[model samples]
Target chain A: MIPVLRAAVNTLVHVPDLVRYGSKPFREGSRPGSFLADLKARLRTFEDAAAYPPHQAFIGNLRPESLADIPSPWYGHPLPGASHQGPFGEILGQGPFYSMLEKADQFGLVSLDAGWTPPANGASAAAKGLMSAGARRGTEKEIRRRIGSGEALALEHEGALIGCIRRDHEEDESLAARVLLENLAAKASGAHALRLLLEKARLPAEEVDYILSCSEEAIGDRYNRGGGNLAKAIGEMAGCPNAAGTDIKAFCAAPVYALVHAAALVQAGVVRNAVVVGGGSLAKLGMKSHRHIEKRMPVLEDVLGGVAFWVGPDDGESPRLNLEMAGRHPSGRPSTPQGMMEALVCEPLARAGRKLREIDKYAVELHNPEVTLPAGAGDVPLTNYRTLAALAVIRGEIGREEIPAFIRDHGMPGFAPTQGHIPAGVPYLGHALAAMRAGTMKSAMVVAKGSLFLGRMTQQADGASIVVES
Target chain B: MDLDNQATIKQLVDAHGAENLVVVLGMSGEGVRIAAETLTTGDPSWAGPLAGVSLGLPVYHILEERVRTRLPAEIYAEKVQLMEMVLDVAQIEDALAGLRKTQAKRS
Candidate 1:
């Protein structure tokens, strides 16, 4: 049998306070004459979490199917049900997130106060979740000494002291406290998803033979800017003692790229179970805060998203990953939207002996409209669906008159955060798995595109797609 | 914006001058702000040839009321109807309005 996607896990780390630390915002706000105070004043408090609709949809507390009926612009219209735990995984809060940072730390760099304790609500249970996830806390210490000596950065929530992350090197700016916080956040969130993957797959940690990290963080010294093995570090944190790992980078397309690679490894019998995971991006938190503030809405990008997929040999029942139907965009192809749709969608369907109308769903760039619309980014997923609909019209699969209905039926609203790789195609896997199990959908395609030009390396766009069938 | 695009815009301005060119952008949201700023105040990103060269050109997003009202209804319906339906037009207009106001103050 060919490789199949056995299980998938999605997690969100609520780090509202950490929004100020996002790479773009932090870098700009730290400069002279920046409006740092105004930004801080606009950030939403944790008490507002219960009323946030997107937050509810993220943790599986609210079904994605229900979101279609919730009316457009889901910000002010808060959904009733709210929970930290979802069917896929939990939305770990700030206190537990801090605990995770310490848990990911190997060199005693993160120091939580001996008397410090997790909050008494959902986060209290998360402390136990961390332990079950195989996160270990070494010798706790009073972090005050290092903080007083200016060798550590205090981790604060709602203006209260929580813990601190110690600087790795006295003078090396590369090991500065801020950089460590970003790195630790990625590892912790990735570990959280890995743990969920093991639980969802009903496999022991040791059974995971290989780990692939497609996270967007660059974890290395200045001498070797992007050199990395974050995958191994995340596996260690998640207690995958036998899992050797490596990192893959393709910008937003990395997750799909990694998924294809995982399928190959499992099909080739190189690894019994290959896990592809991407951690939450701290730098992406509050990515659209300026627009959210202007619109008088909560910063919807406050949560950091993490996802993991367990790929193994086909179990006949699970959704088979049709590698033969995989699509790739060649460098010579035009990077226009229509060109992309042709390369990633049309060509793949043609080769797979399928029709455009046969695809039950298409998960494209899933950036949440709530976070994007206020900033004039428009509805990203809706635009992609429209493009697909137009392509269908041109192919005579659907008439121009059927475009609106076709788009509405084939695609759901964008619900993933704007954390680059986090929103790129894979977020719909958990929902697709459930739909396939219920027989509501027989076939779907996961597609993603990357802006390679963002790195200033090349103007070429990167993209890949794979068909999933029940 | 790329330097080549900015260089082309610069040549166009030099040939026809800034006053005659009312830059109209079909971009949505923050994209309108970036392109408008590039025309009116100069390239804010500074990666292009328009850096520090204030063209002070009047700019409008195709979704804005000013430009939408001017276009023939049938042509507008055919060309931009779908994009307008999906974009947050009011927010995009407001962003351009604010930028234009800021540029006016600077001039």
Candidate 2:
């Protein structure tokens, strides 16, 4: 019999940093009166003004209790731990081989192996010269200190050590997405790592009944017209002849959503075995690292994107997909964006009849704090999770008094500067599965949210939650 | 000029009084109605006059159908353009003068 979800693993590699050696170089011709410059200036003003003393002054200017009432998961949690020094070198030293083995052993990942291509010449030169030079010379100490103190930055996985690729530098979104996916596919050589994991589990390629890929991309696309096409590219490379990829566009919640979909397919007798995989993209990494790069932040380049998995049987031992509930709300609603998120995410989970306190761990929006904080939003995923928890209490799923303790017990500060897909949803699956298997927890939930406004047409916000049971 | 929906090409030419009138035909819709009125009335404001007439089906039918299918209640106007074809630029200028005469009479 095939095991349900035998194992899951996540690996975050550090990328090299970009080095800028001039007075903050604004885009040429983007001087006063230019729309681009004006927008940048406005954003800079808001970011700077937010950091002023007398937090109450800014707070007073807004509606009373506006900031206070908004619940956040990281609200009183200690700042996240600092990155281990020698970022990329430290990651290389740790190696995917060792980390995967250790994690697999802990999670009962039956057959497992890991590998990565070394940084390319350009990447190595930039890493050594730009990244190390900037750090040693203290050129961006304030930014680095913030990063050291957990400020988020954009990150992209180029050829080697994940680095901060500037979003503004990209001329075309489609081309940028294609390059990012191609770079990731080239590095892993597609299907080799998957095959190794399958072999360790004693499963053959053809026996693999279905494949659920969770990298971030729009569904039903023809070419590079939509989001990145990582699934189609990897599926072709893996040669799973029966493979048909479905996009789980739920941002970070993707991996878990993929896991849930695979489990459901297996339970329905559709496929005997399935593989859930996602590769990191440079664009997502770059967006997260942008703030740090602009300020010459320390550890500005350690965000690396990596692929991971959960391979198991249609029916066997391990956590099973018990999708107790799922929810979504369209963007046309006149309600506030926060209200939209609650209706789509928090309400559905509550209706599933699971108390917030009953859930041993709630994994939602695990975006790297360092990557998002410098932009002034704080950890998005953590904030969403906390809000859900608070809503649960308000709804009587848990006592209002227990909300604080529940959040404190169940939350994680941040994971890595991986893209929305990396830390947002799937990172905790491995740990959650392990805890379930060990009977430490009966169930866990993974939540992911995304903005559809990026398309410029849809004001819609969407998210998904998956329940896994041991 | 109230041009009937089923008006013929000859009738349109006789009413407009152009020696070699161009009759651009299209499926019955906003474009067709506008073209018929402009041909009958010979008003430059409503529709430009034609020298050597041409008839073609409506270009906006597909777009109209699509919009109708998706948002039936939404009101949308069809964009249409008419041009006169003459033997030369000089004849084109003469057509414009004839068009002005008809327009002036209507005003």
Candidate 3:
């Protein structure tokens, strides 16, 4: 048994963020255009997102009224205490995130608070720098002055620039401040959630034996592209220097992959404690918001989402990750939605000799509906749960008539933001643990799925699952 | 988008190299058709790069069947490339062997 001691989720949005970043100017040539005007005109206001039900849910501030009235196509209103600090994690706006990147690495941060200190060795960056996406165009001296300036410019005509992060050599564009800031934000956010888990477990930060960072950040200089050490870098920032770590990438399935690895390590007595953590994605911010704003719905997808948990030696107390019976979609399996559920749900239950009703809950891609619904992706979590129920009926584990009751009893409304990797099977963990402890629930199936073709590596859609018992 | 199933199957088979399939399956054309039929029954929603393997078994099974093909089996099985055809000597020899056996029995 591997216990998930604590879980945390955080949200952040830079309004002139992904939308501005993905515009033409950032890609090749620097010809500024009217894109910024269009963005500013229709961008989601902080108040609008702050009052959105899904945002409140991501930060763990969702009201019972909102949770109970789950099936309504409309989100009635924001919870009363939506502004309160989340029980799970904090919801930070971009201004604070800019400062967080600075605070994440004070030494790398320019003392001016807003700007970055330029690399002392101008020759290296000049020689080695290839203009990567978001690469800063400046001389070493110009960069140095920008760093030293008290009011260092954090924004240009379009996007926000959170000071530069440096590499071993001042000259590598691969370690450009832009890339470094992205990496640091991921690291800081992962550490933020890690620290929350540490507090929850009452365990010393240093006591963690290993850290597995499963975030979507791919940090690189021009030469390596995505040559990475993200997990180790995050471990350093999260105050777990003693813990050895590495990254595990499977797109949205990464956290579950990390969980399996962590559980294996703990269960095998290789480590006493291991933590799996992931930060939100900036690339995904405003990803689905154009549809929302167009439909007159709040751009509920405005916030980034994150989650972290400790996989420790089970105490015979906490909710248990049942490693013996895990479900996996073989690389040969079909990649349809029904195929995913069959491989990840029914097969695992078959292996365990348990019926569908025996499992109390199913947590599969919990992307909040407020965001996905308007975007035509539909209610992802509800769809996944209902798919599980449908599969159960097909397997004759339950009658078709029982499907409605099964959903009402076992399915949780989607609350996680569609932060690509974070939304997979992790959001309900906080609630699942509480339910298990309260004796209202016995076990759950945590399923994580991914589109493998995104990497162009394989045609197969990837998935994995594990039974978590009370 | 090109739903002409037979042409699509031929294109896929050619792209994937049926020389290996001819050697592996014994019944070359039948195996090709089976593989193609499995591929073209693709999910209408997913017309992306994964169209072939998305709904089918893992690419591994298509490459390596339930029976393992060993290293030494390729030593004598050679093929001539005449643009569209990979004429394998092994497949040719197998057919000749069957023809000879039947002819000798008739005689």
Candidate 4:
């Protein structure tokens, strides 16, 4: 069996307006020099404390929301205005992370206490300051001179160009995806981040049997371009002859689903190993930051995107794939809070022949409550987990009074960016794996739920679950 | 007869004597029609004497009406024995041999 998720790292990339909470308009001179200076100072303070290496920070000024303004068929909904509050608040809030941690605690889920939070203002000045004093500190004049000369705008945090995000003024989704991947690959030295991940796992290029990637769409000269070719890309990138790709598109649930898929492939002896990787997008970041920036609220500035992952064999002792279950209700059925909870949790557990109290922790839809709870009923993941816990208690699995403690112990408030699949499924994998390895908990469940009505194409609700055990 | 009826006839032949005798081979739609035509025309030079036959929908749906309208009346009236066989490479090889023998006798 593949070992559980060993470690993970993530970064969020966003425009200045998103970082500043819209008080500093995109147009120059909108904010006085003093205000800009103070803003920069606050950003520098937080940047110092963020754990990422200095070279990894990449800044972009152009807002993706502006480019995606025109109505397009590919998007599930009309792109929101630049100032919408919902996406931003949810992506940056600490409440979700707190709630998830609380839930995990309630269920006796053990995770690393070394969790990192993005600065209140998205800035890395503090991190830049930590670099060696001898490193070159180019002034704005030098930076402007380079931009004016039409040279490649090299972004330096302490002093290196780890990655960059460039805008492709193209309408075609597939072509755009290719451009982004190719651009980032070239800048990041042939996608060294992912290559390093494979190397760390001690998985040879030739031995790699499959690729499970979480790209939003698949299509290209690349393997499985549309939906099922992530493995192929990894194979090609890793220089493995047997590598091929497949896609999983459940927004946040994809990585866990991909993990389950890789495990199954190993069990079936189809191939000895597989890799699941996701490339982040700028469009999904700072979605609601524009609104906060406009309202002069604290802009959640950490918008640098990076990928990290899980690698191992199926049926092993380090971390075992203990259980996986999914719950979904077909569209058009009457919305029942009770029924939804049962379908989302109880039914799947029953089918797996497991009871509620037997599992140590249950990680359910742990999205930020500040972003989701204010929207109304059926918006928050924590609510769903609480309801499920209540149902489990009512079903006599535990005492009714234990619901509060159960939630507090079993959940983690959402600390992930609202990058769809990034936060929802895989964010907790790293910490959960570490805990399992330490033998703090025997087993934990990662659950995800998505709203299908937003797409309007289907009336079906979607969910998925996976258990990690030591 | 057109391709659809010819395919049906070929299926029938394979089902019956193909296994019992030996050797089986698949022919193109056009090839089956030509073989059926030679048999229907009472030409002694035609090689194969079919012992059994079956019919199936032609692979191409566009040819259905045309093949259906053109089938010979005598072939339609002939009762074919049906035999279900599991498809495997060895079984297919055996059926082909039977077809060759039938063709040799007819010729």
- Cα distance off (Å), candidate 2, residue A134: 33
Give the winner by DockQ: 1 or 3. Answer: 1
Docking class of 3: incorrect
Best by lDDT: 1
How many clashes in each candidate?
1, 32, 7, 84
lDDT of 1 by residue, A1-470 (tens): 49998988888877877887887678778688664566677765554554466666665566565788888667657766566667776677677787778767878787766566756346423234553232343233556677888998777777666678888888777778888888888989998888887876787888899999999888887686678889999998888999998998999999988998999888888988899999989888877787677677766777888999999898889998888888889999977677788899999899867888899999899888878877777788988898888778767788778988988778888888899998898888888888899989888899999999988989888899988889
Give the TM-score, chain B only, in order for the candidates: 0.90, 0.23, 0.22, 0.23
Residue-by-residue lDDT tens digits, candidate 2, B34-83: 44444544332332333233332221222233333453332221111101
**Which lDDT tens digits does candidate 4 get at residues A4-117?**
454343334333322332222323226455244334333322232132221111111111112223332211232222221111111112212122212212111111122222
Error of 2 at A424 (Å): 2.3
Chain A TM-scores of all predicted models: 0.93, 0.61, 0.82, 0.61
The DockQ of predicted model 2 stands at: 0.01
What's model 1's overall lDDT?
0.80
In candidate 3 chain A, where is summed lDDT lowest over 10 consecutive residues?
Answer: A122-131
Query: Which candidate has the highest DockQ of all?
Result: 1
Collision pairs in model 1: A376-B29
Instruction: Provide the lowest-lDDT 10-residue window in model 1 chain A.
Output: A131-140
Count: clashes, candidate 2: 32
